[model samples]
Target: MTSHHPAPRPARPVADLFSADGRLKAIPRKPARREALLAHLAATLFEDGRDYREPEVNEALLAVHEDFPALRRYLVIGGFLGRTKDGSTYRRQQQPGSPGGAIFAVA
Candidate 1:
C-alpha cells in the first residue's frame, strides 16, 4: 500500500506581505520569509555606499512599518544592514560578487 501526501503550498510573493497602503502587515515569523522581506526592504529602502544616521534609518523604515526599531534590528541581525560600533550609522551590505558594492539581491 502507498501513502499519499499533500503538496506544499507555494510561498507568498513578497509584495503580498504588504498592506494596500504599502505598510508591511507584520514581520514574517518563518525564517525564509523573513529573510526575503528583509532583503526586499534593504534593496528598496536604502542606497548603496551611503551611510545613514539612526534617525535617517528610522525615517525610511517608518515609511513601511510603525515598528521601525524591530525592522531595524532584524535588518542588522540578518546581515542585510550593517551598523557602526555605537549604532550611530547604518549602511546596506553589498551583494556577493558585485562590483563597487551594489545593493543586495533577494535571491
Candidate 2:
C-alpha cells in the first residue's frame, strides 16, 4: 500500500483568525492579552536574536502604556527582558551569541 501525507492547511485570514468579539480564541490563557502585547514588543525590540535599548523599545510601546514603571515591570516579571544592576533600561533576556541562540516562548 502507498503511504500518503495530507496536504498542509491554508493559513487563516486575519479577520477570520480574530473572532467577531475581537478576542483571540486560540490563545486560551488568562493573561493572553498581556502575552500578546509583550510578544509584539519583543519582536519589535529584537533584531536577528539580539536585544535593543529602552528608548527604542519604549518608543514602540509608548502609545500603549501611560506609565513607564508599570510597562517595564510587566515585561521584566514576564521574563521577556531583564535590567542591569545600574540604572539602565530594559534588555531582552536571551543573549544573542549563545549556543542555542535566542528564544522567547509563551509565558
Candidate 3:
C-alpha cells in the first residue's frame, strides 16, 4: 500500500500583502517576510543615488501606509536604506554583490 500526501502550496507574491488601493495592509511579523517587504519598498520608493530629506521620506512612506515612522525605522535598521550621520538625508542602500557594492552593512 502506498501512502498519499497532499501537494505543497506555492508561496504567495509579496504584492498580495498590499490592498487594492496599493496601501500595505499590515507589517509582517516574520523577519524574512518583513525584509522582503522592506526591500521592495526601498527599491520602489527611493532612488539609489538621490538623497531625500526626512519629510520627503515620510511623504513617500505615508503613501503606502499610515505608520510611516515604523516603516522608516525598519528600512534603516534592515540596511535597505541609509541615512546620513546628521540624519538629514536618506538613500537606498545597494544590495550585496551588486555592481557598486553595498553602501551600508546589512545585519
Candidate 4:
C-alpha cells in the first residue's frame, strides 16, 4: 500500500523589523518608513502660538505614532516647539517671541 503522508510545507522568512537599539519595529511608524510623523504632530499640537502638553499631545499622537525618543527630541532640537519646564505645554517657535518661525496648522 502507498503511504498517505503529505509533503512538508516550505518555510517563509519573518518580515519582522527592528530598530537600531534592537527594539521591535512592529509599531509600523519607523522614521525611515514614515518621515511625515513629526509634521503631523506639529500641525496637531500647535495652535495660536501655543503648544500642547504631553498628555494632550500623546493623546493626539500616541494612537497613530510610534514611541521614538529620537523623533520627539528632533522636534525639540529643531525648535519646532519648546517644551515647558512643567512639561504641560508647548510654545510654538517663530511665534511672537520667535524672530523667524513658521506657523503650523492642520488643514
- Best-matching candidate per TM-score: 3
Error of 3 at 6 (Å): 27
Question: 1-107 in candidate 2: lDDT tens per residue?
Answer: 22363433233333332456654334223354554555555555555445557776666555444455555666676666776666365667653224432234334
TM-score of each: 0.77, 0.46, 0.78, 0.43
After superposition, candidate 3 runs with Cα above 4 Å error: 1-11, 96-107
Per-residue CA lDDT of model 1 for 22-99, tens digit only, reads: 999999887667777888999999999999999999999999999999899888867778999999999999642234
Backbone clashes for every candidate come to 0, 0, 0, 1
Residue pairs with clashing backbones, model 1:
none
Question: When superposed on Cα atoms, how far off is each prediction in RMSD?
Answer: 8.9, 8.4, 8.0, 17.0
| Worst 10-residue lDDT window, candidate 3 | 1-10
Cα lDDT listed for each candidate: 0.82, 0.52, 0.81, 0.48
Which segments of model 2 are wrong by more than 4 Å? 1-29, 48-53, 95-107
Candidate 4 lDDT, tens digit per residue, 22-91? 4435533433222233444455556646556676655544444466454455556545568888767766
Find the candidate with the highest lDDT and give its number. Answer: 1
**Clash pairs (backbone) in predicted model 2:** none
The TM-score ranking, best first, is 3, 1, 2, 4
